[model samples]
Target: MSTPALTLHGVGKRFGDVQALHDVDVTVESGTVHCILGENGAGKSTLCNLVFGGYPPDTGRIALGGKDFRPDSPAAAMAAGVAMVHQHFSLVTTMTVAENLLLTQHGLRLRRQDLTDRLDEIAQTYRLRVDLDQQVATMPVGARQKVEIVKALLRDPSLILLDEPTGVLDPAEIDALIDTCRAIAADGKAVVLVTHKLGEVARVADAATVLRRGTVAGGGRMSTTSIAQLLTAMVGRTAADLDPTVAATIGLDPADAVTHRVGAAPTSISGPDAAEPRSITTSKTSVPMGETGSTASALTRAPIVEHGAESVAPRVDNESGSAAAVLTVDRVTVHRADGSTALNDARLVVYPGEIVGIAGVEGNGQSELVAVLAGDTPVSGGTVTLADTDITTANPATRTGLGIGIVPEDRHRDAMVAEMTLAENLFLGRLGRFRRFGLLDKQAMGRAAKAELDRFDVRAAGPWVPMGSLSGGNQQKVVLARELSAANLRCLVAAQPTRGLDIGAVDFVLTQLRRAATAGCGVLVVSSEVPELLALCDRVFVAYRGALAGPVETSDPAAAQQISELMMGVAA
Candidate 1:
């Protein structure tokens, strides 16, 4: 056979005392989609970085087509017929699609027309749809992802790596991506798909490899194994069946629970200094049912109502007693830079132990809502109360001090400082943990950061490397590790907490959100993906063209459908 497209032998990585990947070996055949499966911190992203030359491995040899291959940087990797489409879009928003696509043109400047024409041809040929003339920022998330793929394809790579390509896509968009991947493989390029979603694996992958604690757990053809078997290999256990109590906690009507995943793993709360040899269990330890006083606060009604029920009685939690709201927003209006309205008189509330989801189409004020909650932006007119304290006028720092942690919608631009070290990034504003006499305690910070990194499974070249150096998926883990470690948090504002994470990471993040709720903290998660909202939130509020259409209880289909239509701005 033609030399394996890419191979790694005795690959390993370590940070101070943690061994991220150890004596790992993997081989990818030409023109086939190879999958890397693992739970959060399983070193999936680490392996990708090493392959792409983000940095050299601590110990190992990488070969391409029977020859030793070593790329010094991303540019070198591209030169060696390897390309990566990061979990985060790397295109500059201000640049036109063509300009970004052929950015490196030549040592000398090239004609813009030539670049655009060539880009158009390539786009059409690959069936990767994108408008060459459009400014990248104007495109939706799914479209932007397409641009990233186009950029990679332009390099004419023989090996392509897609890092969590479906994380930000809607259900329909995911289908398109699946088709695109199929086409890419058909082109005879070796493809490495790094993701944690088992469904995605079942849908598009050919052969599969499982990584656990930085080592290869197993490998097999996708067609020969079941999703449950994959999960067992990745997490080192037969994945736990969803606890019936979890379905009740999320207010899933028993009927609805049957269709969706119930009681999988929870989101991760560990920091960057997480231990090496990551745990295989993806689910967080479940909060004892009703411990947060949520047992009687909400009721679950069947998705289908009995024909004789009078007007469908509202589900009420008998155990939930009247309690002061921790977060309250009233008649809030958000406006664009040009004075156009984004959110008009929208209102919402969340009590402690409640996880509220705000769902809408892209560009429908979801970003604005997250900004306002995180105190990154000021609302034009509204009341925002946190623990009965008016925080409408608070700054981002103040809100954070008041015990609100935010996993922003745009992890790169809003949440992370690219040039900073992992340790510094994690301790962004809260330096108390590593400050001495008002001076930064470097040693303490590194140690602390290492602990969180291992705990959260954040993959990076080194703790001190610039944040921008790691893969997008790993960067997201850094953001999660930092924000969730806030000990005094009373509430959290997470916008797409699992945006670029793999299936294992997805489970870890959801579990963390549940943990926060169980600890009596209020959580407001805003996402465009409806299924994510359905799976994680205790209640969902639909937004349409900036209006708070309806706060739907997740108990029945009628309420969810009503909210769904409102999300489309349809009349009830």
Candidate 2:
């Protein structure tokens, strides 16, 4: 038999008091896509880092192509034919894509034209196109993700590790990435996909290993292992114990949601009312997985909806439409830093006690809209009002003072400082509030932060730990805890609130949003996941080409279809 592409036996890693991974065993053969599946803090990233040489294992052995492999650094790993695409990007934000790629080359004096040609060649071969001269900082999260993929591919490694690659991609982009993974494996290379998304595993993975709390819980060939088996292994719970909404969110059927047979016909998994499943496909003619059909079909479908009438959590009554609007964007127009129009004639209204959602493909003016609302970018034309007060020209600090809380999309870059402690991050913009006698009252701030962290169920060492030390989910919780705890919060603009969270974390965050709305705070969520919008929002809108579409009520049976059409610019 041919030697496996990679192997790990009894691998264990520890950091301080935390056992990140322990007694783990895995093998990846050539010409196969191996998935590392687990929830947040399940040690999936740790395992990937161990292989990519981001960190060293405290025990056991790893081999690459039948040879002992102990790479002290990422450079050594790359030299030994291992490349990695991190969940959080690793690009120099100040540089262009071409320059970033050039930095990864072996020689320091390589010509730019030769590197560009090589990048173009790899991009064409893998269908992973990226703008060569685009600044990494200016690109959207999805675009950055593509650049990362292309950068990894440029290495021409035998094994590539992708950590949560699809977390930021749209449905069409996701389909394209899956195709890319398949192509890479077909070319006799090994692919290691680290993710918590079950639908993705159903589509692209040849085999999977489930991790729970730093140990291997279950694993096998994708053809044999059932979705229920995998879910149970990851969370230590049966399908019945799983929340139906979460089950549907992650691409498992609420009833008999077990097997996701690849290439099988669409499965009509019953929704709340057991209505017939509707046929919905993405703009790329691919079906989205985990909605009402097979994983592939469900993933390709654009309109994510329940089989029957739209069922959402109980929300405060806003049907009267008589209440004064808490936030209003009237014909708002925003210009990009380059003087190009980013948002044009965009109008929206959010009343008190409502959860409003904005859904669209990335780079469709969503970021612009968020920025305008957050008071980061001034609107070139039109008025923004908070509770009948015109604040179109309000700055970020002014907006925050006016009870407008913002949870920006890029949490690490725009929301929190990684180097700061949890207590400091929790009170980042509002440090003045904790002042005593013209001095920073750090002790009081720490005590308050600890209370809020406990309230939000944030798992961390304490308020003194650096915010970067927390898991993605825990970090998000800290952000939410800080924003939602505002003394005068009236409206919240949360962008991609649940982008990379685990199932449990997703549920917690959504519940908090709902709770905030119930407490008479207007909530606006911007997300790429249509199903998430459908499940959470009372009314959903689509942002396209710097414009706003319908406020499609979630109660409408055809809401998903309408939103999908609006996103694709084909709304009737």
User: Total clashing residue pairs per candidate?
Assistant: 32, 12
Residues 1-572 of candidate 1 have per-residue lDDT tens digits of 67889999998999777788999989988878888888657788788988898988989899987799888898888888999988767998998887786676353264677766766776666677678789988898889998888878877789999876777775557767777788888888889998766656656778888898888877666555545455556654333333222232223332222322222332221234322222222222212121111111123221212212212222232223476777888998888898999889989888887788888777788788888888877899988888867888899888878888889877888889998888888889877777799898888888888889987777775678898877566787788777778887888888877665544455456656666676777889887655456545667887778887667765544444555566667655
Determine the C-alpha RMSD for candidate 1 after optimal superposition of all C-alphas.
9.8
Ten-residue region with minimum lDDT total, candidate 1: 288-297
In candidate 2, what are the lDDT values of residues 162-281, reduced to their tens digit? 999888887667777788899889889999998777777878889999888999988888766766667667765544443334544564434434434444433333324232322222
| Model 2: lowest-lDDT 10 consecutive positions | 295-304
lDDT of 1: 0.70
